[model samples]
Target: MEIDYSTIKVIGFDADDTLWVNETYFREAELEFAKLLSGFETPNKIDQELFKKEIGNLPLYGYGIKAFTLSMVECALELSNYTLPNATIEKILNIGKNMLNKPVELLDGVEEVLEQLSKKYRLILATKGDLLDQERKLEKSGLTTYFHHIEVLSDKQNANYSKLLNHLDINPSEFLMVGNSLKSDVLPLVNIKAKAIHVPFHNTWAHEMVTQKETSGKKYETINTLRDLLKMV
Candidate 1:
């Protein structure tokens, strides 16, 4: 189970929950969204339906707050049998706007870890989300300088990672990815013969979750915080 770090040349980082507070805000927005539609369905039902809608809409919208807001609006209309009011629709839009405007809050030791590691290995950001929103966060993050490359992927799959590694001319054995989602961050890299470290965030979107069966033979390291990465690399 020992992962050799001596061969790693390029380190990829997942942006959202790994470097900053992302899912926590989404959780808060979900609560607010549920409250807005409480008259149509209970909060629990709304949450379940919303998650279903998100999964169903993934191909069309991809990941990001805009897609989530659109899904929320669609769920509201469907739950109310298309009788949802304009006022409620407006409230949902406002919720998305609020999230977009919220300040970027970096997770503990994010900058320090990035700063320290950048001095050695080449750093790249391997994250997936809406391009505009991801660009906005990177701009606000103030940690942009540490990264040598930034990729905003439409999805994180083995093929996607292969393409990225190929584009960067990096060998799988010499690459490592760090992130919070096992499905997006760890499994894909492991499948591609690369190293991955899982830094779990307290809250994760339902869509990004994976069963133990899916990760059964995946080889990766799990760290409690970004600060712990300083010791690894």
Candidate 2:
């Protein structure tokens, strides 16, 4: 089935892996964290346990480096049966701090795409993460000026998107979301009657992965890179 972008009045971009490097940092941090706990478990087992802790803690802390850091601490304590050394814990803390302080690296053509699209459509930053961290990255990204509205969501479900579009007075048909996660960015919008374009990141958190059955019949476009938007919209 053919879809139309002519009616799209607003284009939403996912922040983390969409406009800049984010998940990659988390992956690197996880590796460092696993190594830190190697005394208690092998790197592979440590990684598995940390992921379980993260998933278990998602409801309590939501998503972001802070939550992830906390999960790491918890996982370390649990894996070591609470005998983990103070130095190891400190290293974990430093790992999270380093991730937070790392410089923002924008993906190729992110600026050009935003610059071009902002001229014709209202662009919004519709991403879910720690509010302070997201704001910090936005400031560092130097792309904040392109967004007409910025939203830091707790989660990117259908209701969340619906509320954002409703507040902006944009009908679902007139909103298009571009992002890296099919679960968070594509499926939710498509379910809400909005158009979506998937620009996949090289790495994604396992929690965000959806089965083929979930996306098999979805109507949306998938582009290889952000620059590809120039040709589409």
| TM-score to true structure, per model | 0.98, 0.99
Error of 1 at 3 (Å): 1.2
Query: Which residue pairs clash within candidate 2?
Result: none
lDDT of 2 by residue, 93-152 (tens): 999999999999999999999999999999999999899999999999999899999999
Clashing pairs in 1: none
lDDT of each: 0.94, 0.94
Runs off by more than 4 Å, candidate 2? none
Instruction: State the lDDT of candidate 1 residue by residue for 35-109, as single tens digits.
Output: 988888999999999999999999999999999999999999999999999998999999999999989999999
